[model samples]
Target: METLRWQDHTLYLLDQTQLPLTETYLTCTRWPAVADAIRCLAVRGAPAIGVAATYGAVLGAQKIAGETTDAAAFGDRFLAVCDALEGTRPTAVNLHWALARMRDVAAAALKTDSCTAVVGRLEAEAMRIDEADREINRRMGQFGAAELAQLGRPLTILTHCNAGALATAAFGTALGVVRALHAQGLVRMVYADETRPLLQGARLTTTELAADGIPVTLITDNMAAWTMKTKGIDAVIVGADRIAANGDTANKIGTYGVALLAAAHGIPFYVAAPVSTFDRTLEDGTGIPIEERAADEVRQCGGLATALPEISVFNPAFDVTPHEYITAIVTEHGVLHHPDSQVLHEFFRKEGI
Candidate 1:
């Protein structure tokens, strides 16, 4: 599969505000515009949001150069830009993590150089963050592949949401594992949940899998139980938006239901994500704030559905899956089983996350 690459000094982002109907790309050239896109979900996915925010920081630095003459004023403006982007989407810890790292680099640059040098340094650091995300995605895929191989050959796996190339700089998290499994001839089938309200599973994951020539079965969100019962689903893999120190994961809405069902069926439910998804600052899932989407998203059907004039909709873009439901958490660094803060903090410090 061809990996999607980010444009330098340009943000080639999916205009998610027009998804399922239009595949639009927004080229963000300024920090505020980039932050607004993320807040409005013109660009999404945990890893992708982080990448966008990193680029947004660079754009901020460029904007500062053009707007200010004082070095201190420029640095303050840059920090404010980073803060705004970091808050664009709160569920994804990666957004703040990436931006914070960028701010640190920017702060360091200010101590030893002129304004011109600072801008150049921030640009290079932003590029490093983007490149690192790609490498992490690929390596996480490799780690997840080893775990999937242990299940058996020709394995049937179920997944929810869009966690493929569209979700990250390269490869993906959970979908990356699915891709690697197919590459190794271990996956015989993939069942994609429609991921209602957003239809990321149907619109994004299924498309990517099919593009790779991997057989995919699309089913309504409620059909997961039936598919597992008749098709012998061996495992369930999902991407995490945020992972608490206790191992509880926050992902797309309905993911908790999928995990509960997977446990009932005795299927191993695994979460594949980069180390950046881990939030050591948070003790458990309870502290993670779930993003509630527009009511219309739940009340109405966007594609191929009969229209209803009046209906109340409860739409949450994501849900938290308790730690007990997760069999393992696979990262670019390694795979963790039933992890605790001790293990999580160690990895965070080791990776300087």
Candidate 2:
């Protein structure tokens, strides 16, 4: 499924916040609307957010194109739009990476082209980023499937949150690997964690897998350890929001706990993500900013209150898994086994990142 679509200066996002119940799309003609979608979780996931932000930049440039003829003025306003979109979410490195690429394209185009022409360049770049993400996911799927197939049996995989086609441009990161394995008839069943605060797993992950005819069993977040212990799970794979230089990963809240469980069971805990999700500047997960969401998100489920109105809630949208707990970091380039700072550095350097 295409998470984002751009046509004639307008961007369309598959409204993820309404998934499984209502398959709706949000039309965004302006940059702020796109930013709002990202902030509101109408469009989410690291790679999908990156793709949306790029198109958001294109929309911003198109708006500037109409308001100003001067290239310098357009450049300043376009940058302000990028800044707003980047601020929508702090944890996803893909958002920052996507915006940086758009900024570079604009900076270069403004020197030799008109504001209108710069808008064209930005649009083209946005499309390229969108297409590249889908291709990257496919490659990551192949690499991860090849690595996991070594288990030498039909495998039962456990996953947290919703890292499926709905979460990316197309295919997925962790779920893409699952799809690849299933295609090879190597998958027995998929166990999905009903990610709380928002049941992305129950509402989104299972929905995606079911649509593709993949056998999936949904379980609550707390049931993960017992399930792994009794169900003979061979691997645990999840997607990342941001990966630090030391291979420490930040993903949906409760993912750290899942990693710890996978560790105790001797199951290979894998993180599947594109290279763009890596923030090489941050030496470890501590340096990665974690976005804490509204208290109501914890106090209620699906807008039905589950707690007292005045009760306090600590709701962090994501958590960091220490590098040691990760068995491997799977990427479009290759799989990094027992990833560490030095190994990651060497891997990226070899890949010319």
Candidate 3:
């Protein structure tokens, strides 16, 4: 199933919050609606949001297509939409990267054309971005599966959060690796962590895997260590929102702890993501900003109160996993055994990335 769709100049996102029970879609015709979807996690995951924002910029351009007689004024409105979408999620570099590409496309189009032409060009670019992402994820899956084969067959894999087809254009990042292996009949089962507060793993990931007829078992966040020790997990593969120059990663909350557990248990911890997820300007994970979500997310589950209202709560959407904890990183370009600034630089140079 398509996680998102474009019809009649509107972006329709699969409402992830209502997963595992009810399936719903949110139709966004305006850029503001797109922003809200991103903020509420309706259209999440780094690559997915990047593609969404690119299309949102196209809608913004459409809104001001005939409003301005001057090209400069039209560019202003388009840039504003990009700026607004860029602010939706700070942890993911893909959001900014996509918007920057849109801006460049807009500038180049306006150099010799009208605002209406720019709108068409933006729409074309958005579609190109979406297709490119799907292809990237597919390639990443192949590369990641190969990486796991080197360690031995990954019969039992453990993953955190929802990184399946729902998380990206089609195949997922971390889940993409699983999908690739599963396609080969190599995967026996997948253990998904019921990410606390949001329960994305329980609601979205398990459902997605089950829909594909893949074996899946759900477990609570705290049960990861026990499961790993007893279940004989072969590998831990997770998605990344941002990667630092040194390979430090920012992913769904509790991933750092999961990585630690895997390392302690002698399980290889692998990260799968597109090359766009890396931020070269950031020296390390310390520079990544963590988005703190609403406290209500932790106080309730499925609209039912589970904790005292007055009790203290700390809800961060993500956490940074130190590079040292990572066994290897799989990207569409290829796999990096262990990445530091110098090695990463060499990789980019070698891959022409």
lDDT of 3 by residue, 1-353 (tens): 57899888999989887777889998989889889999998888899999998988988888899677589998887888899999999898999999999999999999999888889999999999999999999999999887776655648999999877898989999899998898888898899999988888999899989988889999999999999999989999999999999999999999999999998999989999899999999999999999998888999988899899998988999999999999889999989887778878999999887
TM-score for each candidate, following the candidate numbering? 0.93, 0.99, 0.98
Model 3: residues with Cα > 4 Å off, grouped in runs? 151-154
Candidate 2 clashing pairs?
none
| Clash number for candidate 2 | 0
Give the TM-score (vs. native) of candidate 1.
0.93
In angstroms, give how far residue 132 of model 3 lies from its true place: 0.4
Tens-digit lDDT track of model 2 for 1-353:
56888887789898888888888999999999999999999888999999999999988888889999998899889899999999999999999999999999999999999899898898899999999999999999999999999999999999999888888999999999999999999999999999998999998999999999999999999999999999999999999999999999999999999999998988999999999999999989999999999999989998999999899999999999999999999999999999999999999889898
Ranking the candidates on TM-score from highest down gives 2, 3, 1
How much lDDT does each candidate structure score?
Answer: 0.84, 0.94, 0.90
Give the 10-residue window scoring lowest on summed lDDT in candidate 1.
1-10
Task: Count clashing residue pairs per candidate.
Answer: 0, 0, 0
Point to the candidate with the largest lDDT: 2
